[model samples]
Target: MSETESKKPGYAEIASHFRKLIADGTLAPGDEMPSMRDVCEEFNVAITTANRAFRTLKEEGLTVVRPGRKTLVADQPRVAATASARLKRIARTGKPYAPNERSVDHTAQLRSMADPMLAQLLNVELHDEIVLRTRTFVRDGKRTVFAVSCIHMRAIIDVPELLSPEPFGQFWQEVYTARTGKVVTKSPERRGARLALDHELEALGVDVPAGTPVPVLVLVNTFSDEDGPIEVWEDVYAPGLWQVDTE
Candidate 1:
């Protein structure tokens, strides 16, 4: 172990230190964050710890990791409180509505078979029946959140037409309850990030010139009830679209 590695700070502490800097205006928007070496020296931590701390900050919408190994404060820093409030509203209404959104445009259809990747995610055999719901939450003609959901039907023997895109998840929920007689009690989600692919960049409407990769979030959610899992979905939220509650 090196000298600095002997007294490395915990991941939480590193994230907290930077968050304080940003909140107090010491680290203004567009300000470059400290280099990995700087963080290692300042916190007496290893480079890996520093990297994790940086990842945490990025997930919380506090920082942006740019090209050339640069990290800077994010423009239009999101308020976690605001995101949480909107999340509560979405939960109650079963709609993908957000603040400042006048309406939502949903388009969903049932597929005869779940693809291999989705089958693995749902942990069921491949070629099983499923419904793929694609929705774009728009406000004033600007897309806020573009999302997709995969509903597995290994358990459900019968279901009504889930063709309509309006009314959010109301009809889907009704069909779910009617078929399984189980109320969906939980739908937990996990957040992660990676470089955007060509198709993904187009879908998210991100514009990046050649040789540049846009960072994006990848979230996985599991919808379940008392007996077993009901639906599994993976949603991607563009930068400046969503935030992780830190407060």
Candidate 2:
């Protein structure tokens, strides 16, 4: 065979080279790969030829693309946390709220309270700060909804009476007006999609097979007064219970 014809296969050869690099730990996870030009120069090949090789690697889940950045090695088979398996149950059914706690039901409440865009629409004094409170609702051992609430710290501190858990029943706007002497404003938005994590499935009580995908709902909220933004809260729904409407 001619020297050119005798050379090893093209794309397969390139793929093998990269695979060795990965297997040998030379190209570790999160490591940025050389650019196409660099690979072409190193391999003494055309840019198109180098591109074909890289494409094969990407198709095999060996690398990922980061917009505005270089391609990098991906963590193969991605390791998941044990907590992920319990996130759905805890998020959807847990009682009492803790800071940074994850629960689907409570997250929904936070989502609802923060739905209104508050900061951009409200005008407020410089001394004011925003406060966010979130909780979850469960019925018969199943989580149903998530809720969130927010108000200005300065606006709510006056009524020590309102600080009690029962005060939450009073409308937030009324409480704001009573404290700040100004009306509160709200802006809300809703979105829905599939769950992207294992924890999401656990909280939603959905059975995700080894490879099954889950769906989710998202709510964005903003609270404000006549001056400017107060707080922003987001709630993500568990899988199987929400249908996201899209245009």
Candidate 3:
């Protein structure tokens, strides 16, 4: 049998399929999800595998399970949409943000890689030429995250828009795909915490207590296709603006 034919759908793959459906609005709020038996038959998976997929959705706050009622899509998703999910929304709609959400483009320019951590993450030499795109994300008129996107110089050559100071108003990966035909298939992410640097505090407009070190949540995502890395995005979330959604 071929490799593709030998593979079976796992819980993560099942959950991702449903996530895309919800992200694109195919599964609207209050829509009843298929029963576990239905899922099992559809994917030809065992009951345990199907149940695990549903459990993953529930843990992500994308679905609600009542005591005596069927599982339904949550009216308001507690967890933020994944990057790929947001891209799906942007593809359908013109913008990604909700009515009360917006982003301010701070700067986009070609610069030398200064941070050793970023260089290592991007798999580039120190002081290598890279494109820097910075933005501030706001929700309900409050600054929530300061974001920085580091792109290899190749992207700017392939898709010149990466050097534009003005926002593309869409994910650049889509633009890159359009220009170079290299589709992003995977995006690995990492999370950590660190004390806010002086520039980061200024950019986020955060004030730290005198003589006290203020910590910020850091989320880094690396976008890549089959070939390799496309871009690295680092988001510094303001304190009190980050929350874990367990519901």
RMSD of each: 9.8, 18.9, 5.8
Error of 1 at 180 (Å): 5.1
Per-candidate TM equals: 0.53, 0.36, 0.64
Candidate 2 vs. true structure, TM-score: 0.36
lDDT of 3 by residue, 45-119 (tens): 889999999998988777999889999987765444434445556666656764346788579988899989888
Candidate 2, residues 73-179, lDDT tens digits: the string is 87642211111212322233342321123233332111122323444333334333445455444432455344444554554455444344442444445556777
Between candidates 1 and 3, which one is better according to TM-score? Answer: 3
lDDT (C-alpha) at residue 38 in model 2: 86
Residue-wise C-alpha lDDT for candidate 1, range 1-247, written one tens digit per residue: 8865665679888887776556445677789999989998888777998999999999888899888768998865553223333344445455444333543445667675545655776666777667767765454355544566677655335554555556534446556677767787545456787676675566656778865867766666666667566676665566656554432
Residue ranges of candidate 3 with Cα displaced over 4 Å: 1-85, 88-94, 209-211, 243-247
Candidate 1: worst-modelled 10 consecutive residues by lDDT: 79-88
Count of steric clashes across candidates, in order: 0, 38, 0
Whole-model lDDT per candidate: 0.64, 0.51, 0.76
